[model samples]
Target: MARIMSGVQPTGNLHIGNYLGALVNWVRLQDQYEAYFSIVDLHALTGRPEPAALRHAVREVAIGVLASGVDPERATVFVQSHVPQHTELAWVLTCLTPLGDLNRMTQFKDKSQHQPDNINTGLFTYPVLQTADIVLYRADRVPVGEDQEQHLELARETVRRFNHVYGETFPEPQVVKSSAPRVMGLDGESKMSKSRNNEIGLFETADETMLKLRGAKTDPARLRKTDKGTPEVCNIYSYHGFFTGEVQRAAIATGCRSAQLGCVDCKKLLAQNLEVVKGPIRERAAVLREQPRRLEEILAAGAHRARAEAEKTMVLVRERVGLGAPRS
Candidate 1:
C-alpha cells in the first residue's frame, strides 16, 4: 500500500467544510492506505498566537480529528512537533530550496497581502516545511484539495532536488485529489474558515449547526418564497449534494425551480440530514474531549510510532549528506 501523509493547521474550530472536504476523506484513506495525520501546530505559529491558545488549539484539533472518524489504531495521528525530524528535515530542505521559488509561491503573496506587517520568514518558508512533512515520512501519496495543488507540486520538486543532491533519498509524493464536495460557508462568499466567522464547527450541537444552515445565503436573485430560483447557483444546494441523497437533491432542485419549496424548509431538510451524519461525530468528540488523558496517550503512542519511521529516514538522510559521525 502507498504511504499517505497529510495534516491540518490547528488554527481554530474546524467547520463542516473541513470535515467534508478533508477529514471525511482522511478517515476513508486510513483504511485504504498507510496514513499519517498530524495536527500541524508548527504551521499555526506563522500567525504569532499566544502560547496557551496554541496549546489549546492543538488539543482541540486532535479531538476534532478523533471525533471526525480518524481511528488512531488504523492511522498514525500525532502532533507535528512531537516528531522532531519534521523540522530537522525542513532545515535541510530549506537550504536546498531556491529563494526565487519561494518568492513565486501564490500563497505567500496572498498571505503577505492579507497581513503585510507580519510577513515573517517562517511564513515565506511554509511550503518547505510542508515538503519536509511529506518527504520525511517518504509518503508516496498526499491527499489534497485544488487549493493545495501548488504546495504538493513544490513537495514533489523538493523530493527530486534532494534526491539529485543527496542520492535517491525521498519519493516524489503524488496528489490524491479529494472526491468530497467543495463546501462553502454561510456567507456564500469564500471558503468556510474560522477567521471569517462563517463556519459551523464539527463538534457543535445539532441545533447550533441547524441555526447556521437556516441562515445561510442562497441564490441572490430569489427574493421571496414564491420566486423560482436556480438550485445550481445556490451554495445551500451544493451542501445538499453532500448531505442529502440523490433522490432528495433531485426533489429539492425541482421544488426550488417550481417555487414549491421555501428556502427555510429547504434549509431545515439540510439541517436534518447534516445532523444525521454529524450527530455521532459530535457525540464521539464530546467523549474524547472529556477523556483528556486518553487523548494525550493516543498522541504519545502515535508520536512513538511516527518517530520510529522518521528516525529510520533520518539515518539514511544523515548518511547521504555525511552529517553524522563516521561509522566505525
Candidate 2:
C-alpha cells in the first residue's frame, strides 16, 4: 500500500471545519493507504502555547482524531514531537531552503503579519519542518487542504533539491485533495481557525455547537425572514452541502432562495443535523478522555512504529550526507 503522511496541529478546540474538511476524509483513506496521522504539537509551538495548555491540546487532538474515525489499528497515529527525527531532518532541510523560498510562502507572510511582535525563525522556517515531516517517512501522498497546497508544492521542491544533491533518496510526495477542502468559519469570511475564534469545535457538546451555529453569519442580503437569500452565497448552505444529504441540501437551497425558510429556523435545522453527525464523535472522545493511560499507550506504540520507519530513512540519509559513522 502507498504510504500517506498527514497531521493536524494540536489547536485544542478542534471544530466541525476540521471534521468535514480533513479528519473525516482521513478516516476513509486508512484502508487504502499506510496512513501516518500525527498530532503535530511541534507545529503548534509557533503560537507559543503555555506548557500545560500544549499538553492538553495534544491530548485533545489525539482523542478527537481517534473519535472522528481514524482507526489507530489501521493508521499509525502518533505525536510529532515523540519522533525526534522530524526536528533532526528539519534542520538538514532548513540549510538547503533558500530565504527567498521561505519569504514567498503566503502563510509565513500572513502569520508574520498576525504576530509581528513575536515573529521568530520557527515561523519563517515552518515549511521546511513540514517538508521534513513528509519526506522523513518517504510518504507517497499527503492529504492537504487548499491552504496547504503551496506548502506541499514547496515540499515537492525540497524533494527534488534533495534528490539532485544526494542522488534520489526520497520520492516526490503527491497531494490527496480533500473532497470538501476549504470549510469556511462561522464568520463566513475566513477559514475555520482557532486563532480566528470563528470555529465550532467538533467535540463541543451538542448544545454548545447549536449555540455557535445560532450566531453564525449567513447571507447578509437576507435581512428579514421573508427576504430571498441566495444559498450559493450563504455559508450555512455550504455547510449543508457537507452535513446535509443532497435532497435536504436542495430543500435548503430552494427554501433560502424562495424566502420559505427563516435564517433562525434554517440555522436550527443545520444545528440538528450537525449534532446528529458529530454528537457520537464527541461522546467517544469523552470516553477516550477518561482513559488517559490508553491514549498514552497508543502514542507510545505509534511512536515506536513511526521511529522504526524514520530511523531507516535517516540511516540512509546520514550515509548519503556523511553525517553518521562512515559505512564500511
Candidate 3:
C-alpha cells in the first residue's frame, strides 16, 4: 500500500468541521494506505501557546483522533515533536526553499496580518516545515483541505528543487482531497475555527451542540416560517449534506424551498444527525481521558515506530548532504 501522511494541530478542541473535513476521511483511508496521522505539536508552537495548555491539548487531540476511529493498530498515530527528525529535515528543506515562494503564500500573509506583533520567522517558513513533514515520511499522498492546497503545491515545488539539487531523494507527494474540503463555520462568514468562536466542539454534549446550532446562520431570506428559503445558500443545510442522509437531505431541501420547514426545525435535525456521529466519539474520548497512561503508551509506541522510519530517511539524507556521522 502507498504511504499517506497527514496531521492535525494540537491547538484546542477539535470541532465538527474537523470531523467532516479530515478525521472522517482519515478513518476511511487507514485501511487502504500506510497511514501516519500525527498530532503536530511543533506546528502549534507558532501561536506561543502555554506549555501546560499545549501538553493538555496534545493529549486531547490524540484522544479525538483515536476516538474518531483512527486505530493505532492500523495507523501510526504519533506526536510530531516526539519525532525530532521532522524539524531536522525541515531545516534542510528551508535552506533550499525560495524566499519568494514563501512570500507568495497566502496563509503566511494572512497569518502575518492576524498576528502582526508576532510575525515570527516560523510563521513565514511554516510551509517549509510542512514540506519536511511530508517528505520526511516519504509520504506519496497527503490528505488536505482546500485551504492547504497552496501549501501542498509548495511542498511539491520544494521536493522538486531538492530532487534537482540532491538527485531524486524524495518522490513528490500527491494530494488526497477531502470530500468536504471547506466546512464553513456557524457564522457562515469563514471556515469553522476555534479562534473564530463559530465552531461546534466535537466533544460537546448534545445540549451544548444544539445550543450552538440554534444561533447558526441559515438562509438570509428566511424571515418567518411562511417565507420560502433556498437551502443552497444556507450554511446549516450545507452541514446537513455531510451529516444527514441523502433521502433526508433531499426532504429537508424540499421542505426548505416549500416553506414547510422552519430554520429552527432544520437546525434541530442537523444537531440530531451530528449527535449520531459525535456521541460515540465523545464517549470514547472520555474513556481515554480517564486513562492518561494508556494514551501515553499509544503515543510512545507510535513515536518509536515513527522514529525508526524517520531515521532511515535521515541516514540517506545525511549521506546525500554530506552531514557528520550519526550521533552516538
Query: What are the lDDT scores of the predictions, listed in order?
Result: 0.89, 0.90, 0.92
Clashing pairs in 1: none
Residue 152 in candidate 1, Cα distance off native in Å: 0.6
How well does candidate 2 match the true structure in TM-score terms?
Answer: 0.97
Expressed as tens digits, the lDDT of each residue in 272-324 for candidate 3 is 99999999999999999999999999999999999999998999998888797
Candidate number that wins on TM-score, 2 or 3: 3
Lowest lDDT sum, 10 consecutive residues, model 2, at 319-328
Q: Mark the 10 consecutive residues where model 3 has the least summed lDDT.
A: 319-328
Off by over 4 Å in 3: none
The number of the candidate with the highest lDDT is 3
The best-first sequence of candidates by lDDT reads 3, 2, 1
lDDT of each residue in 3-44, candidate 2, tens digit only: 999989987688887887779888999989999988899998
The TM-score-based order of candidates, best leading, equals: 3, 2, 1
- Pairs that collide in candidate 3 are none
| Tens-digit lDDT string for candidate 1 (121-228) | 999999999999998899999999877888888888888999999788788898888986456788999888887788878877778987887778999999999999
Taking all chains together, the TM-score of candidate 3 against the true structure is 0.98
Q: What is the lDDT for 89 in model 1?
A: 88
